[model samples]
Target chain A: MIQIENLQKEFTIHHLNKTLHAVRDISFTVEKGSFLGIVGKSGSGKSTILKSIYGTYIPKSGAIYYDSETLGKINLVTASPREILHLRKYEIGYVSQFLSVMPRTTALELVEQALLETGVSYEKAHEEAIDTLKHFDLDESLWNNYPNYFSGGEKLRLNIARAVVKKPRLLLLDEPTASLDNASKLKVRESIEKLKHQGTTLIGIFHDLEFMDGLCDEVFTMRKAVVNAYEA
Target chain B: MHVEQPILQIKNLSKQYGAGCSNCLQPNARLEKNFCPVCKTVFACKDVSIDLYRGEILGIVGESGSGKSTLMKSLYFDEEVTSGEGYLEDFHNGSLNIFTQSGQQKRYIRNALLGMVYQNPMLGLKMSFSSISNIAEKQIAAGSRHVGNMVNRSNELLNQVNIPLKRSKEPPKNFSGGMQQRVQIAKALSSNPPILLLDEVTTGLDLSVQASVLDLIKTIQRELQISMIVVSHDLAVIRMLADRTIVMLNGQIIEQGLTDQILEDPQHAYTQQLVYSLL
Candidate 1:
């Protein structure tokens, strides 16, 4: 479960001598095992809010209270770098819009890395990564190949598989299906639905309203740095 | 929350190439690109600090003159640090500063606890020495006296790096650029060091070769669980190998965080430029 109160985040462009308020006084709470979808246009601060909760961008003024399974309740905004790292290792899983693939790393190895970092044994990580990739519908032949040469949709599937392989308590997806085909999108949706059924908290940014309508428990429409939430 | 201690900890590590004047020695001295305009002092590495956790690759990315290589050299004891404290978990229970150790102690540490792979094969490997001898040389330095054991270990290391056993008897000068670099890596791993310092390891290789070398580094880290400090001007290489990345500018760390964070949402202007350029 996560509670974000008065989450205000701003970016200062030093060279331009201007400050951009990405998110201004947003508040929301996601209950345990619930899926929250954020729908917004470009620069609506949807990704910024996710980044704040993910501890990538430090909010100017806010508190993101996370009920960490290991460290108990802690404000992500004020958590030390060490605690944030620990949370990232064992609790949070983030799938950004674009897959940041390491060159020469096979798809299987890339997914396995997530589990390996969390202290999973090599054999177990490898096996789980394979299973996750299979569940995501990635072809077996492509598992040993580098993702650099893969199509955009394949890369996105690989990214999702890597993040969800370890079954993190909190999973943040930033436009994960933005470039996928309808069939690929369906595969992603099924995988996400499976994760949610397993009690994983989900907060995602989606442009496809129909895809989100079927999955999200509530949809929060973000416009011009403001959010309005309603049940789906 | 419980925190894991860094396997290698560096504090205020500074390596100066010239003597400093009073003006340049000030804590707040504004240097012209890591150089003192008034004192003519080249501060190759200025008050650099780093913490390398076990089983992680820490990347140092900077331009050619950003002192990343100097930091690696200092850590490997190839270059003397002007001032700093370096503690290794395997060395005296991390209580002693390695920078202040005696020459013999430093040699012992370098031979047993640390391994270095230089960008230039000529610098890291002997042209006349056979590949097996080059690797065996490191094991021998680490106090392995049995020739039979050294040969077996050297052969195993060469195999790990993908060098053919038949070619292991050939000198490095007879090998290709990529092959020579693989030999250097094999030599570095001969002692089974807990920490590996790689200075521009894949800088000059072909793109395909670079990928293979990077892949080898990743696999080695996973299998050996060695903490590594990988220095390069190439952000792509850093992205591929580093778990955490430190962006250095003018001998100072401008930004550092998880490699994914740095790639996706770089905060500093210099880092933004670097990431955008990669795009």
Candidate 2:
């Protein structure tokens, strides 16, 4: 459901005001139900690609097509902000790399917020949020509790619930397994497998080679700013 | 012969906190001396004795709140130990009692002699600072007089962890979790300190990144010959890295020995259970 053609993004450092070429002409395509893992060391442009796909960072040169819809293609890139702006949160659900959940929000509320943002009705969002939380082993009572009080594993589970509650076709996940423990890690792996089984296309960045090897069907390796072709 | 200098010696370390107020190493045991006049809670650390030698990684294997962090925090002077003293050389003096050192003195030694990396990398760095500047702050905070070369050193170390120079100027908050962790490791090693304490440093990284970072830490330790204390519940990581293993349970050390002794030939019942469960 996703296709990228020679994407490049350059970031200018604020302190030095120097342009650092973070990503240099990287491109790949993911079928409707494929699992893609982008592997790279720090600052290897793994997160930038996901952000670009999610519309957080507007790449300087590149065209992204999701199921025939242009995400970052010049047509939409130059399209008035109003045209592409509404498609982001609705079309692409992103699980941020760091602390995805806010301190004040409950697990249920976070999931509900995601669904509502995508135009789900209030009553429908609430019902879907309950199902999402229950599937992840988050109890109703604890769902009402703020995420700050939840354990690291609980927070990660909530983040996954919030991102996947919408059941978007394209999911951009940024290190979804970082905070989980051994047992919870197993649970998360199973959950991702289920999501893949349901035909939700995924593009995730993970450092855990073992976990990534098991979860990702295709691995994208980037070294020194340039990306090699996707490998299975 | 692996001759080791006794870097830190823990003698009868015990700490009590919260409700229950008893030194109950045995789950059902009831003791009177364990009670405290404060919050009237049971002690968390119980008569813990261990010796950390230089140039070796001491892996503490335990569940959460198992007194591993407690011992580390007290040894690093981040927390106060209720009883027992940790003896260590003062670099110049014959030896210094860790507890006897003043707060400022302990802070100085803590900053210079020890480096701590927490599980969450976000908390470790200033969110606003770039990867280079985050690492630079560690050496600067350690009271190092060399300021001009800090950036250069930062670049080199960040490069060491595979963080590119291009992202060196970008705020670490913008980096991925695995990338942020690499930056944290780079910062921890900036000073090239002697003893390092890592509490779940690889918790937030992907498995592949975890292996790479673990290898990086081992390489750095071998190059610098620094004593390391790695505390984590992941036995696979500890088994792959540590020279010695300490099995902790409910605020007590159930077993302490070489990795082979703990993993292959366990002596304690608790250690046996832990090793067996891992299989």
Where model 2 places Cα greater than 4 Å from the true spot, the runs are A1-232, B1-4, B18-40, B90-94
Best-performing candidate as measured by lDDT: 1
lDDT per prediction? 0.89, 0.74
TM-score of each: 0.94, 0.51
lDDT of each residue in A1-232, candidate 1, tens digit only: 9999999988766556678999998988999999999998999999999998887887889899999999999999998656777898899999987887657778998999889978888899999998999998899999999888889899999999989898999999999998999999998999889989999999999989999977899888898998855555
Task: Compose the digit string of candidate 2's lDDT tens values, residues A134-227.
Answer: 8888767898887878777787888888878877677888988887777766776777788889988899888788888767789999887889
Please name the candidate that would achieve the greatest DockQ relative to the true structure. 1
Report how far off residue A202 is in candidate 1 (Å). 0.5
Candidate 2, position B8, lDDT: 72
DockQ of 1: 0.43
